[model samples]
Target: MNALFLTFLFPLIGFLLLSFSRGRLGENLSALIGVGSVGLSAATSAWIIYQFNVAPPEAGVFTQQLWVWMSVEGFAPSFTLHLDGLSLTMLGVVTGVGFLIHLFASWYMRGEEGYSRFFAYTNLFIFSMLLLVLGDNLLLLYFGWEGVGLCSYLLIGFYYSNPNNGNAALKAFIVTRVGDVFMAFGLFILYMQLGTLNIQELLTLAPQKFAAGDPWLTLATLALLGGAVGKSAQLPLQTWLADAMAGPTPVSALIHAATMVTAGVYLIARTNGLFLLTPDVLELVGIVGGVTLVLAGFAALVQTDIKRILAYSTMSQIGYMFLALGVGAWEAAIFHLMTHAFFKALLFLASGAVINACHHEQNIFKMGGLWKKLPLAYASFIVGGAALAALPLITAGFYSKDEILWEAFASGNSELLYAGLAGAFLTSIYTFRLIFIAFHGEQKTEAHGGHGVAYWLPLSTLIVLSTFVGALISPPLAGVLPQSVGHAGGEAQHSLEIASGAIAIAGILLAAMLFLGKRRLVTAIAASAPGRFLGAWWYAAWGFDWLYALLFVKPYLLICRLLGRDPLDHAIGLIPATVRSSHEAMTSTETGYLRWYAASLALGAVVVLGIIVLA
Candidate 1:
């Protein structure tokens, strides 16, 4: 526990050293600093976890206060780190999975432009996320929250030469900012009502200060949920994620798996006390999750880009975590968050490998039958895909996702439970859809396999974790969060699990039948009028981007065009305009001619004499 500060220190050092070097360092040295720093943080995290488990803190929480950040009339928040099962779980994910992603990134980004720059941004991302989960107070957490947003903008637009990439980055930043604004308002409400931003303190005082279903509390929780939705990429704010694949694949993995997208789930779970009081907001969380999962699933089914498929899958998976949070399954939510980091990271990294192997081709339809050529990537896809599809009993995803479904069912929310089941079915279809299309069929293009320890090591490790082995590592969330509500016993839980598992397998079989052969049947369906229309709609992510453009973007741009002259600026410019005009008129008499100059001087002198005499 004493060494907890080291977790942040190492990553900060890595970011500073890499950033200041400004690409002067050799790629090898840069990779060493970048990967080594995160590795050290992960090591420190493991040791802290050991210490924590060996000697559990009194009251199951520990706070390490560094200094008072600021004080204004007793409104003070400290630069403090809070540790408990929840933060610890997230800490492990951030440092552990984060380190693996950095290591794999070294291989993936080796010869790319701005290699050092890539690592620097990723290092900063990890540092910011660490700050977010570790922060004891809302202000500190919000600082981290905003920090990651900035980092995502930098990394997502890492390839700034492309206008599309820049637009994608801007889109991500702006969409998330909307949610951040809501979160800020929520923070203000909490502080105004209960007078503190410290998370533990706020949770302690919330129930006592406001009764359940209080309007203010409900508003505050809803505001916080808004922030979560934006960050987590749920529903209306989800359009940016697919475009975010315009960046490098490792950037995709880091954002999708380890850091930015999961922040929302963490927020809701961390502030469960407040959410519990606002049941309406809590149910909304589940509803958003339910809708997002099903919609994202459908969208993933139509994506041609391998990375975009994974991006939508991430949204759907986070939707599951949100659903868990909504149903009072606190541990299940965090548990799924952990397992999700493992497999989602694997899938993204493997997709990077496949893209590299196939000569930078991203469209899955462009290449095929690479199982022999790119065996590592094929195996990675298989294992990660299985985990994603929640192949019963043997994969990490099965354990986590099955728990979410059970919780949903146990809560008596049949709609949500069915949504989870539907998402499971869709997951299998899309997961295998990518696999069967990209790894099976006739070879469409030449491919090469990735070689070297850096490339294979991360993939291999994640492969192991994506299995049931990962599920064995249960989150240390006992007593840190409220015990889950309405636990369903033996027979009921088993039945739901089996049903979900069967649905997943059924989806995979359907995908195989549709895609594993000539793909003629799918082609015909896609060519048909209704199928084409539906396919295009899903491929465009149900036209959310278009809808948003019509509703918000077009109107805003129209207003900008209408006010193109900037009325306020023109109004302010009036004084300067008048002064310039008067000066020009006066200057007309003093032309660049000696006679004119002399005349003007004489006239001025006469006027001065007349004024003096008159006075």
Candidate 2:
């Protein structure tokens, strides 16, 4: 447990060293500091895991309190790290997958401008994310939460010279902040009501203080969900994620796969106690997840950019996790989160390799028959794509996704079950569609990039993890979180799994039919008026950006214009204006003239004599 703090410390040190270098350091040293630091963090995580397994902590939880953060009338949250199965799972993902992504970045970012700066931001990101998962209290968690947000802004706009990239970074920051505000209100409500921000204490006190379906409890959880939605890029807040591809591909991998987008899922699972008290908000969480998965699936279907497709896929996969959480399939949600990290990281890193190989071209349409030119990337895509599509028993995604589908089914939520099925179908279609169109067709661009040890090591490792081997490494969450209700584990579960697996295969077959070979069918469909309209709509992520502009952005700007100069400021200025005017008038009367002084004195005396006579 003592080694737990070292997980974040290594990356913190790396960030400091790299930041001080100011991009003056050579790429080798910078990579060593950046990638090596995360590797060390990963190593620390392994040691902690070994220790936790060798001698399980009391209550299957360990808390390391370094010092009391502050004490105010018995309200104190400490600088502490809490380790349990849940946080341990997230710790492994953040450090392990993060280390691999960092390694791939070393190769992907070679010869790029500000190379050291990129690694510095990524190291800081790893530090922030680790803090987020490992914190013992909500206040500390929120500090880490905001830390990751700031790092995301910095990394997403790593190419600050490009206005579009900067705008994308700002968009991600602003959108997530909307959720952060809601989460902040939720935290305030929790502390005000429970008198503690410590997570375990809050969980213990919540049920005693508030009955099930309590309005105040519901409000707090709902606000927390709002924060999750924005951070995870669900529903209206999701527009920023697709545009986030304006950054480099590794940044895309880091955000989509292991860090920023998964924060929402982690938040909900972490606060399962509060959510369990508010069933309605929990159901809403499921609805948001269900609807988002379907919508993002459709959006992925029409995307042309290599990364945007994967971006929408990330959103859709997270939607599945949300759906699982909403259904009280807590472990299932977490399980999918873990498995998604494996495959999604593989896909993004491989996509980066492909882009670099093809001279940085990202259009799937522009990259065809590349399987021969780049066999390693091609294999990476196949393995990663199969896992993403959840192609039956061979891929890790099938096991995790099927668990979610079964949970939805077992919960007897027909609507959610259907949504999960549909999203799965859509996921398979678009995933294989990308693979077929990008890898199988005639070669459209000349592909040439050296396949060094840097490229193969990380990509190969991820490829292995994306397979069924990764599925075997389950999160030890049996006692940590509540056991899932409604898990019958009978023929019914098998039937649903088989059915869902069939649906996945069907979607892949459809993708092959449509995208493989000549792609005339997809082309014709695209050329049709209705197809064109639908494609555009889906491609714009169901017109969310437009709707937000109309509903929120436009009105805000219009109000700003109407105000012109704040009327309250003008009103407050009147007292100062009057004082200044009187001062000027009195100053004019004080002219240096003896006659004027004598006249004033005579007037005063006359007034005095008049008053005396009257008296």
Candidate 3:
């Protein structure tokens, strides 16, 4: 078997083992398998990267075919793996960071009753995500897409005993399903038009086969965008991600930060050739991403819960990535994806450590002055926060996010550029707002105390990576993508870097002034109408449960009542009544007495003879 298969296979093996063990395995053994599987996959991914560097695939791509998985009516979808710079980058991030999160979870979830089950779901999520990145064709990709959705639902509701968690998971599944339906239709249209689902072949044929403004291409692109939007928690479909903070912190790190959410960005980047064919659709992507960026950033600004703040922040950062992909900056988008996976995962895990130490307290107002006690977590949080805030000359987020902003400005999409800049400012403000409020305030609650090295070790490792990984991508990523795609300039200039750095610093200062230096200012603002609106998520999320109740539950009950009296029951009852009448009529035709049976038989014979004579 090829190494690509092993990347997916090992996690699946862990899932199966842990699943079968059913909470029976010793805690140590369960943790080992869970972490080990992803660790091995990470090692395998590194080897694959080494091989690719040594003997780079033609045009920076490689393919491995497993077998013909299915065929129908001259259409065949194979179980194949395609490796390229794109897939390789994603593989390393998913398995590498994924392994770290798993290890972190082992310590984080040490005393939880469902420790084994938690690992099982985590491994399964890894397996699905690997399949998503490694798949060669659309069918296989869809399989992986749904697989990850299932895993997400399972992991989000890992604490099944909690009704709120279950509801959150269901909401995620249902909302994403709406998008997945469109994605499925889009895939069907592609196969019907192109006659193949192989991504490489599709890319090769897409340019010549489809016209620049073809309606089918536009529709297909939009449909696929729907999927991306839902998965990435873009505007209108973003509510679930905020609610998903109900899951364990490691789950948040793995799913929201590193793996599951990035799939959407990956989808757009992987299909750059198809998207390039449709400029209108590309513009739509920019518009949606830009709007989502602004909306989510504002949402992040007011959230009190630490994870909800990160959740909204994740949405905003993903919006930037989408903006990059939208403006034809594929390489920059993927670069940001990598940087995001590192720092966001770090931030979430570090937050988890803090939340654990504080006895499950997540309210930023309740947390303060633990920087001295949980020094490692504090340090990791700072590294992650710097990356998030895009501080000058220090963090990965600065490099990747700044690159996207430059591309957006230089891409002839000025409106999008302006929106992106505003979002950037907000991003910086909200990120550090969380940092200063949570870490820099006076201690209000008693510290529940800190943990052993096992807890801090994974967070520290991520912190180091978060600080450094941004610079590694320029050479490899810039080399692959065409110059026309990224920005007007060939590479990032010092002046542009300084300007972005300045914007970031300004945002930080502004946040400090409003939330920290002048606390009364924020309080006064919150007393005002606009601040109230901001706190309420601009009313987008207000009465959400009630809206669901009125729209889904109350309406369903009304329909049930109406149907019960007027239509549904009566219509349904008619079928059984008609069957009963038919049975009674047939019973009359059949006589219980032997003499009646004989007479009927004789009558039938006489009738047949008469008909024959007449003919």
Candidate 4:
């Protein structure tokens, strides 16, 4: 089998092993199978990368068609695999980082009642994500898209005992479906316009075949953007991610931090060819991304739940990536995606360790001085926090984030640059706020700390990777793309770098001043008006459950009630009751059943005879 086939097949093997074994396999063995499957996929992916570098694909893209999966009057979709610079980068992130998270989950989920089920879902999620990146056609990509959605629903609702967990899962699915509808329409538009779903064909034909600024292209791009927005949890659709914290911590680490959420960035980057044809749509991407970054950063600032804070941070970080893709810095955006995955996964996993140590208390206010008790987690948290803050010169986040900001400025999109910088400042405050409140203060909770190797090993590995992966992208990933699509020189200027660094430092200092210095004063301020607003995420996240109730549940109930008493129903019921009465009245006419029946038959025969005679 080819390398790409092996890369996807191993995960499926794991899913099947765990799924078929169900109640037969021991928990530890099942966990091993799950982690091992992804481990194998990661190794295969590494081999694919080696092959790619050694003997790069011609035409700057490679495709392998397995067979025609479907054919009709005018449409055909094949089972295909595509390898390009973009897909290779995403493959490394999904499989490589995904494997690490699986290892971490093995520990985090140990001894849980549904450990086997957890691994099954994780393996399935990885397989689906791989398919998403590797598909050569839009139809195949959509298959992966829906596959991930299915796996997400299953994993999110893994704790089916809790009504809240089910609700959260439903909310995520239903909300994203709204965007999926638009995405489906966009796909249909492309098929109708171009008569093919193959991404390679579409990209090749897009420049000359589709006119610049065509309304159809604009509509299709916008529709696709809607899907991205929903999946990435951008803007109004973001509330579900915070509520998603109802799942297990490991689930949060995998689905929320590392893999599933990045699908939006991947979508935009993969379709950059089409997006390039419509500059206006691309600008809109920048605007939406910038707004989401700032808004989510503010939301992160006030969240008391450790996971909720990180959830908002995930939204903010993804916004930055989208902004990079928007302004034509595809490489920089993807670079940031790789970096974000490492640090964000580290943060969430380390937080899991902390919560586990603290007897499952997730409120940051209730946690303090955990650094001494869980030193490994503390170290990982600090490293992850530095990345989140994008502190100068040391963290991987600094390199990727600064590159994006520099590109934004050079592109002369000042509004986006300013918004992005403002979001950066807020990011610093919120990240450190969680760090200080949870790890810096006097011990506020009883700490039962005996974290095993299971906990520390994964965090340590991620910490090391997060510290060094940023520099590799410029070299390893650079050659994968065509030179034309690679980092263009005019984008990353020295002056822009210095300015971005200055702004980032200022933001970090501001965070330190507000949270670390005069801590009690900050608490008192939070109790007051402006701080309360900031803490409440500016009320954008308020009454979320109630909002759903008012908008969906209540209206649906009202409609059902109205339909129950409709005029048609009343008329039908009256007719049925009258028909029953008429039947009762007619029953008396049949008292002498045989004679009456014979008389009726004779009368009918005589009438027929008379009509025939007249004719």
Question: Local distance difference test, per candidate?
Answer: 0.92, 0.92, 0.84, 0.83
Report, for all candidates in order, the number of backbone clashes: 0, 0, 0, 0
- TM-score: which candidate is best? 1
Q: Judging by lDDT, tell me the better candidate of 3 and 4.
A: 3
Candidate order by lDDT, highest to lowest?
Answer: 1, 2, 3, 4
Residue 116 in candidate 3, Cα distance off native in Å = 0.7
437-519: candidate 4 lDDT, tens digit per residue: 89876888987664666667778878876775654555244544222222454635666667666776786676667766457
Off by over 4 Å in 2: 565-615
Clashes of 4: 0
Model 4: CA > 4 A from native: 450-453, 475-492, 537-553, 581-615
TM-score of each: 0.95, 0.93, 0.90, 0.91
Q: Give the worst 10-residue stretch by lDDT in candidate 2.
A: 448-457
Q: lDDT at 411 for candidate 2?
A: 88
Worst 10 residues of 1 by lDDT: 480-489
lDDT of 1 by residue, 103-168 (tens): 989998988899989989888988999999999999999999999999989988999999999999
Global Cα RMSD, each model: 2.9, 3.3, 5.3, 4.0
* lDDT value, residue 41 of candidate 2: 98
Please report how far candidate 4 places residue 243 from its true position, in Å. 1.2
